[model samples]
Target: MDPNEHSNRLSTEFISLVEKINTLSNRTRSSEQPFLGALEQWRIESQQTLDSFCNEKRQTFINSRLEELNRLRTNVEELACVQDVTQQNTNSIKTSIDRIEQDINKIQFNFRPLLIDEHLIVRRSQDLLPFPPSNQAIELTDSSYAVLAGNKQHLLVHREPTLCLLDRQLTIIKETSWPLDDISDICWSSVLNRFIVINSQYVFILDERTMVLEQCLTSDTVNWIRGTCSDTKLYLSTEGIGSSIFEYTLMPSIVLLKEWKSPVTCAHNEWIEDLKFHNDFLGLVIGRCKNNAVCFELRSTVTLNCLWSIQLEEVCSMYATRCCPMLNHQWIVVAFRNPRIFHISSGGKLISADKKCRSPSNICQIGSNLLAIWDQKCIYLQNLCCII
Candidate 1:
């Protein structure tokens, strides 16, 4: 049986017993007449038994999950060791492949010859890394993910008040406070040269260099911001009255551009969780559809037109996604609970999936490094270049 399902059953049974005990206590206390000694004694014994059982069950559930987590970690470490050995031997294999390719080229000199590009190939369970310890670790009250802000800087933000910055070594450098109490997400726009903070109700643009709030954009009819991404133009997802993607031009001032509503044809209710612009021609969005999670391909960012949509495999609980355009292959990572990482191709094909960590919430690629956060506490990093 599923561990989570077993845990849920125990929790439900405990809650029901507690409710019954509370009801019995209330009735006994408010009674007009005193209960018999035998009945009172039975009630006390039953309550004690139930409480003991509840405590036992809770501990059993916690222990079971911890064992499972440790097993997963062991497997990841073994895989990493294997990858390290494989990486060392890659140069020799590449040389052999190069010789074969040259021979094939000579044979097919009269006609167009088939060629293999290393970047186009996909590998399974190739990159799952535990994050290296930070030089100076700082914890925040609100659970959040760390984002690389370029220039060897990292950011860890809380929903309210605090936004902490870290240097190259992951040591706390500086922190900035804001009046906005609820920040849904923050994205550093390399194109716009600013950090855009989404607060559900409005959007704040902070100067990237100065880290000061430069401007605030508001919409009278829109709220419930889900996610945001930017190319030359800013793209925002809203789960307000209707789940939709809004496009706006940031230059000069924030001006409404185009809007695309969530597809009602989707088999399940949709909550557009993440919006990402792959380039001017392509964009990607991850969200739910019925019992499955799905990714939609927006062909045109300007018109917000979806060219195709693919349902992700083994995703019972949808979480986060990251697009790697630097690799030129547009490999996207679709992360879900059981904390698996599914690598989807540009054509919406599932290349591979890996159970990387305990609970992966978000993923991002900075240069050659792929970083992910799990269980609201741990961060994992792996270099994609090595796998490629």
Candidate 2:
């Protein structure tokens, strides 16, 4: 063959070798591209798996915490409910205890009896010649027997007659008789140290030391007499077809001071129940008129006003009146014949009534906290708890 043809064949062989290398390089690059794409897909799948695991763990933790919180809230609500029930029970117990205590106190008071102390004493009178009951004439002296006990020991009067002394209980230090006949009333004067005995028309003053008659008083027929040492005045209630109240002064001899006519025109026909003076300006008078109790007030020596003029529900055969000292003014205490104590104010106002008593003469205040009541045979001391 020719040398040119041989050189051309060699070049063709070299060109074939270069083309085979290029084809091999393209095939290797295609295979490497597929592997790289698969590696990137694996990396993305691994990251997605890690993210799903983390999200599931966080959800589980949140669900557990919520369940715990719900459980704690339920426990707190139950505790509050229990506390409310316990409080209600405590209040109920307290109410029950208070009620029981009140009931016990009431029961104890209802069954309790009056208790007597060392301050109480009793003495009996010695037997003497019994005076006629029809001769109601009696007198008391400053040196005579003490009719009232306690603080009233200073109330001994001077010129009272011996016959006018009622329910006497004394040691009988001395005794004397008066010459006056048909004695109507007797009173003792503490300031004058004498006894004043009243007859139908005259009043005789007798000395306690010498038992001698001192002075005599001339006046109209005196029905009742009350002595007041505060104003140095003597009130004499006169009787006629109509009754009248007269005030007198014993200084410089017995002289009439003032007079108050009866408000009721026919007071003499009616029965006089009681008469008392709360003070110098206030006087109380009670009488029975047509089966009714008429209570009236004498404000001054001239002003007479009827306060409460009403009939009692029960027929009162006898009535007693007393004035009780109060913080504001004097309260009137009235004892009916049926043994009922009625409290009335001096202002014509009724306070309380229907306080039952056993006897008219038995109801008396022993001290601040006790009341002495006579029940016909035995004396009952009552505890004045209401005052306490």
Candidate 3:
């Protein structure tokens, strides 16, 4: 039987036992369905209110302007019939014209087209990914691995046996073993054209062309769990609760630039599981040590202030979670314990709750068209056309 089978069955039975009657409030508290339904109703009501207001104001505008319009027409008819211009009639016509112009301007402002954009109209979809992948799932030779795509040219993966640099087709171009200690997380530095790997406090750079791994020792001590890079900065997350995140320079040499402590990095009791950098912002996946409560926050890289945050799960067993940057300024977060995938919008809203039927451990978007998913059984490299 599956490891969680018993728990799943018991939970379902317990839910059935206590569900005497389905009340709106109780059901609403535990699930988002009711709130979503309410939001739809609210939107409909809001649109109806707007339509009613516009229609009422429109009729009122027409009613108020009809008398002025009639007077203007009468004055024009009278002026045309006179044919000869006198100062008194000329002044009267000028006054009527001025009033009509002002009325027209007000009418134009009130009757303008609706102000809305494609961004607001685009509906959020819970579309399952792979969208039937451009190609089949390329099950890798290794059961478990670390895969990352920084450049469009190559993909990197490390297993217990060796570190492999594969081409876009997921074919191994070159392979190497760790020079010193085992590297934990891998990040790509586009500016450097290199991959940065972390082994706790130690830092290393690997060249895919020759498959060589070398250390760039900062000689500092901390629990570095994950690493990701921007054009200029290298961001690393720590392990254990109240974990800290360190920022380093990718310039002259790998040097400490700044340190983000607890409460700044995350709540004092929570830890950062994964982090990704995109468009001058850092995305942090914060998790708890005791339960499966997880949060994905988008923050400003300049000030480290949270722009927005979303709670992915309320209670889950401590499991590894990963965040990948997808096309169109969005995120893909996968929780390994429950084997579920969450697609998030660039604005920190949960776009979809896609459930993965496999026991996949982690996933990554390799460039624009490819996605890599790895587990204890195998690795899957699918197309990202629709996933994004």
Candidate 2: deviation at residue 170, Å?
A: 7.8
TM of each candidate vs. truth: 0.56, 0.42, 0.63
- Poorest stretch of ten by lDDT in candidate 3: 117-126
- What is candidate 2's lDDT per residue for 1-388, written digit by digit as tens? 8999999999999999999999988877783664455546766986898799879977975676566556555655676678456766556555655665565466442334546454433221111112112212123343432121111221111123453211222223343564544444344444455656555566667654555665456664455432222245555555343566666776766777877665542255653333433344544445555554445443443354554443344434443332232212434344545655554454655655654444433233323333333233333333332310
Worst 10 residues of 2 by lDDT: 149-158
Q: After best superposition, candidate 3 residue 224: deviation in angstroms? A: 1.0
What TM-score number comes out for model 1? 0.56
Model 1 poorest 10 in a row by lDDT: 143-152
Residue-pair clash count for candidate 3: 1
lDDT of 1 at 196: 81
lDDT of each: 0.56, 0.45, 0.73
C-alpha RMSD of each candidate structure in angstroms = 27.2, 49.5, 16.6
lDDT of 1 by residue, 198-309 (tens): 7677887776456677546776777745444565677777753247777778777778777777563122365655556565654455555455555655466655565666
In candidate 1, how many Å is residue 286 off?
A: 4.2
